[model samples]
Target: MISFPFSKTPSVYLKGERLFLREPQWSDYRQWANLREKSRAFLTPWEPVWRDDELEKSSFRLRLRHYSEEARSGNAWSLFLFRRSDNVLLGGITLGNIRRGVAQSGQIGYWCGAPHAGQGYMFDALKLVIPFAFSELRLHRLEAACIPSNLRSVRLLEKAGFLLEGTLRSYLKINGLWQDHLLYSLIEGEEQRRGLSVKTTAV
Candidate 1:
């Protein structure tokens, strides 16, 4: 009963054992907005300030459009994470700010709904996407930054084979304040060195 992209579209889709990552669709507005709104308190500390209309239907439509364009242009790939068992929307992850040429790298960011926070769903999604980035996208490195206090994110990146690179002061704005972030990176082949393998379904 799991539904996926019927054919190769401009946007890419990746599937894993327990979850799938795919391009965001406008019809997902209600579920996306509801989960985000309910998880606001749990997520706010680690996220940027939300606009007044951040979760409105109109805003979601615009966001969908942007994800489409980013995927098409090779600038970024924004994907929604869904549970495979029931297709429940679990969270979102973006491999964005892609750079080509000499620097084959991109930045990654992700979030999970509060109700699903402690589960390993996000971890599964990462395993699915990393191979797509390294093998299919043919990128050499992936980077991520997280607030120092966001211990969960730090562990997740490390568990996925990313090494601690350093820190950046006032690196990003979050929850209306400029914050310091610990930077991490994963290079090709690092996964195997760390005893991790990227599992993914072809797009």
Candidate 2:
């Protein structure tokens, strides 16, 4: 069973007014695949082409191994975002590539279920996670990269108190093509002082 206020595993379930974040587990395979399959059309335009082995149990086994490694190294927090009221699987948010010796930072990456786009749930989700990253994990900064054309994600980061730092030319490979990304970052302990509070947006 999972415990709370604990390690990077299935510790406390983070709850917001509409959603909660939980650690991924074997039981989530079906729900995760369903949402991912349904979101393919919407996601494919921005994500890499799916490999034939992506959904196999063999792949999942590898994933579990990687998840364990990431957690043990304190280099990532991979979570499943779910609807609080009905427990629907919405999407996932990953805080990856964490560094601590000098640069205590991690990159935030996320995707929403097809049915949940254009809603502020992602932003609310970020709000809750950011504080936890800073306070609980003692992170110094968090960053996200968005395609220049992804106005939605860019706006979401801005609304969540991240500043547009710069752009990375051809920084990522998406849908089989190299894409540029606009970088956004927020330093720990600064958003509140700047009068920036997390706000909600609805579809």
Instruction: Give all TM-scores, in the order shown.
Output: 0.94, 0.88
Best candidate (score: TM-score)? 1
Worst 10 residues of 1 by lDDT: 1-10
Q: After superposition, how far is residue 120 of candidate 1 from its true place, in Å?
A: 0.8
Off by over 4 Å in 1: 1-9
RMSD of 1: 2.9
Indicate the residue-level lDDT of 187 in model 2: 96
* Global local distance difference test of model 1: 0.87
Clashing pairs in 2: none
lDDT of 1 by residue, 1-203 (tens): 11324542466668888888887888788899999999999999999899999998888888987877777678998899999899899999999999999999999999999999979988888887788888888899999999999999999988888999899999989999999999999999887677677666654
Question: After superposition, which runs of candidate 2 have C-alpha atoms over 4 Å from their true positions?
Answer: 1-12, 194-203
TM-score of 1: 0.94
